[model samples]
Target: MATSYRVGIVGCGSIAQRHTKAYQSVPGFHLAAATEPNTETSRAFQETFAIPKMYADPIEMLQKESLDVVSICTWHGLHAPQTLMAAEHGARAVLCEKPMAVSLDEADQMIAACQASGTKLAIGHQRRFYPGWTEARRLISEGAVGKPTMVTGYVVDGLLNTGSHVIDGMRYVLGDPQPEWVMGAVERKTNRWERDVPIEDCCLGLTNFAGGAQALLQVDLTAYSSADHFTVQGSEGLLMVAPDSLRLISPDNSNGETLPTLWDTHTQSAAGSVGFESYFHIAYTAQAQGLRAWLDGEAGYRSEGTQTRHSVEIMMALYQSVREGEVMRLPLEEGAYPLSAMVAENKLPLRYPEKYDIRDPQRRTWIHREAYDRMRADGLSHPEIMATLFNK
Candidate 1:
């Protein structure tokens, strides 16, 4: 018989909602409890998902609930401390959202805490389960793109939020190579924050993986806006990957090939992917399932903790490169978040000082969550919803 896992969510944001959706879809996973600071949002989440318990504090939730799996679906600043709390409380496993932590020190702390407590920890880079991505990795490994030389990723939004996925995803598709070094640059002409964490207006990074490929990334580095996609250049052919689609141009094929979106999960699962036909929206389900499998004594969890630290290290190393104004080598010495230090040192100061949070209006907090939810239910797009919220 498959074992049941009691799950608790630490933050009731849209990401948590998605997590709840994923949990409910999979069997033997209970919607046991959740934690959110805002009382109104807490109640809304509980009632909306039929969660059995809700708490005003995360520590309280961890202390009270006999949770087997705790999902850390909070802000970037909160991931490390909350993960530490979950580990201390003896959760069987923890599935933290991406970018793992704000710094290498915090990331290492979370890892050590979980390791000490005998708890399994994994990050929510669930997009690694995307069938297209998995197939791309398989094809690359089999030499479809012979000798992958360069991976160029383009993304918008902040590095920790959206860009982290691109960089990590690039690594995953590129056979998860060891990053030898990185050189990075940042621009912060306007005061900008993403989920209350200081961020750059735009940035670019170049990471050279050990003897394999060089990854070049541009985030929010366009005249007006950038996008989320990556291109792989190799000796034999090229491949382009996006969120919903993948295209390959190889020597064997004159015309480019667009891979199928859906694949046999049973076949893919044997190769460290999802075990079911779950895709995009339910990647959380795949991640949770992988954690469950690991707890059940299975090997080969894709988003395993020690492996994810490399992604965090690469990002932090990029920031450190910018801070030191030189190519920063891997196994970085800096433990603190270089961006914060750089800003504190009055480096990367604002040329236009009107401070703003890129996601301020998008957050569904106690105050303005109603109109946003309503507009969303009415089948409105994000831009449309934002227009209605602003017009109101």
Candidate 2:
């Protein structure tokens, strides 16, 4: 008989909705309980998902439920503490969202706690499961694009929220190399803060891998509708990876001798990279698959805690590089929230959203502040607070 794992969700936010739907698609996983600090939101989530139990605190949920897995889909700052609580309370595994934590110290603490309690922790860099990305990795490993030398990704959002995907994606395609150093610069001209974490209007960085490979990251808020492209350059060919598409350009073999040219291109359609295929819900399903594999003692499952920590370390190193105006080395020696420190110092420039079609700046600011205060008072989840402000 197959074992069905009991699952507990820590936050009843927008992401939790996606996770619920994905869990419905996965076999041997039951959505037993959930936690949301806000009363109304928690009730709504419970009703929507048909969750059997709901609580106002995750620790309470952990204490009362015999959950085999706990998904910590909380704010950026709460991931570590909540994960620790979950591990201590006997969760066999935990799935957390990206950016891992705001600082390395917190990330280390989460790793240590999970290790101490024998809990398998997985960060939600589930895009690695996309067929397009996995195929790219396979092709790279197969030497289709011989000796990958450089990689690049263009994104349109904050580092932690959107940029982390690019970083993780690049890492995935490159076979997860050890990062040597990173040099970065950030422009903070916006009031783009996710909960308490500050977001940059534009951030660019170059990360050097141990074996002379390099990855370039360009995240600009101005490119609001950018296609979000990830490309790899190798000694023999070039490959471009997108959500719905994958393109490879290599030598053309035709009449007589074979010759490489720019005119020859091969495109692949990854049907799995479409709507729910490439987006939110499918990712959680992929996560479930990885979890099941690990539980079954399958080899080569990629969501281990150590690898996720490397991704988080790369993120933190980029921020540290931007702040110090120099190349930052890997395995950060110190732990601090560099972005938060910059925000506290008022080092970031105030953005004029009114010029960007956000008219009535005063009223909007007041409303956002009021909503934020409400969230703090009611202990609302991060997604709910964001929804209240943006009317989402």
Candidate 3:
């Protein structure tokens, strides 16, 4: 039997909970310690997970524990520094939450620190492990969908926070091709809850890849409802993976003959063919299993070096496009939107907005009015509409 690896978790947020669950689910892995800034929260997490040790500081946790790996589930801004600290302490591997860090320089520092220390880094893009998505890629590769030409997908959330997944997933499905240029538009239509937040609530972008493949991405935090829509359009067929189901439509009926319907007898003769519905739960479980395999080293997964750099590059490009009001090319120059620039400009609050002030009636009114206008434009106007409507 393989020796169980001792793991430490830093950060006690919701995502950390998921990581905790994943660790518990995987064999040859044991949750040994955890760290959080809040002493009470840290103690609570340790109690809840039956963790043997808890610390208010991650650096101290690393110093105290003999951990094989550490999962850095901290905020996007802190990912780099915390990851570097973890590596410096002799952790063999680090699994960091996505968006890697706020800037390329920070990402580079984290990567360099890990490389110098002989520690491996893995970015948490678990969606790549989803069964349906994996199956779709396999089918595309095997000529089930022919050559992929275009992809249309949207991640319904704020650009920096949730759009990271969409962008990462797109790259995964498209075989991680280098993007040549990107043009995007971001709209801050509502300032309802926290008018001071600087993050774009809605954004639409077009990406041109080096291989001639094109991608259309839409990300919004103010959606009326939640949705995960991914579609790949190939030369001879199309595949769509929605939040609940996977669908494939082919131009050739060679797979099997379709039955003629009385009301639409010409349906089968009209064109191609369609195939089965796949359950979401099955896909989710498959993703979990992939994480298990990666942790076990059953198969080599994409190194943290490539994934982190690519994700940060894409994010920076998106942000640049938004700021410059034009297309931004990749292979960003040395001075392009550095983290220092963001810090100097005081834009951190924009990316990580303060919680909405529910007690302030004026602020609530402003947010509601903005949401109402946005919803009305989207043809989903309703007084009782939840906050999700503006998210898509």
Give the runs in model 2 whose Cα sits over 4 Å from its true position.
221-228, 253-280, 345-392
C-alpha lDDT score of every prediction, in listed order: 0.80, 0.73, 0.64
Highest TM-score among the candidates is held by which one?
A: 1
Candidate 3, residues 1-392, lDDT tens digits: the string is 23788889999866787677666655567889998887778777888889988888898899989888898888666788888998999987888887676677778888899889977777876666554556566666686667788887665535555667777766777777888887776554333222122345466778888777778777653333223458888888787754334577786654532222121222122211323222322322343344445656665564355675876677677767766666888876643443234334553334223334322454555346576567656754222234354443
Q: Write the per-residue lDDT of candidate 1 for residues 72-179, one digit (tens) a residue.
A: 999888999988999999898898998799999999999999999998998888888766677778888898889999988776667888888888888988889999
Model 1: runs farther than 4 Å from truth? 223-228, 243-245, 265-279, 362-392
Which residue pairs clash within candidate 1? none
Which candidate, 1 or 3, has the higher TM-score? 1
Angstrom error at residue 334, model 1: 0.4
Q: Quick one: ranking by TM-score, best first?
A: 1, 2, 3
Best by lDDT: 1
Q: Please give, for residues 1-392, the per-residue lDDT of candidate 2 as tens digits.
A: 23888999988887787677667666778999999988999989988899999998787889889899898888777898998999999888898887788888898999999899989888877777666677788788898778999998876546777787888888888999999988888776545565456666568878998877799887762333223358888887788875445678777421222222221011112113335434444556667777866766676468677787776788788888877778898767758877767767766655433212122243345446665666645755333444455553
TM-score of each: 0.86, 0.82, 0.76
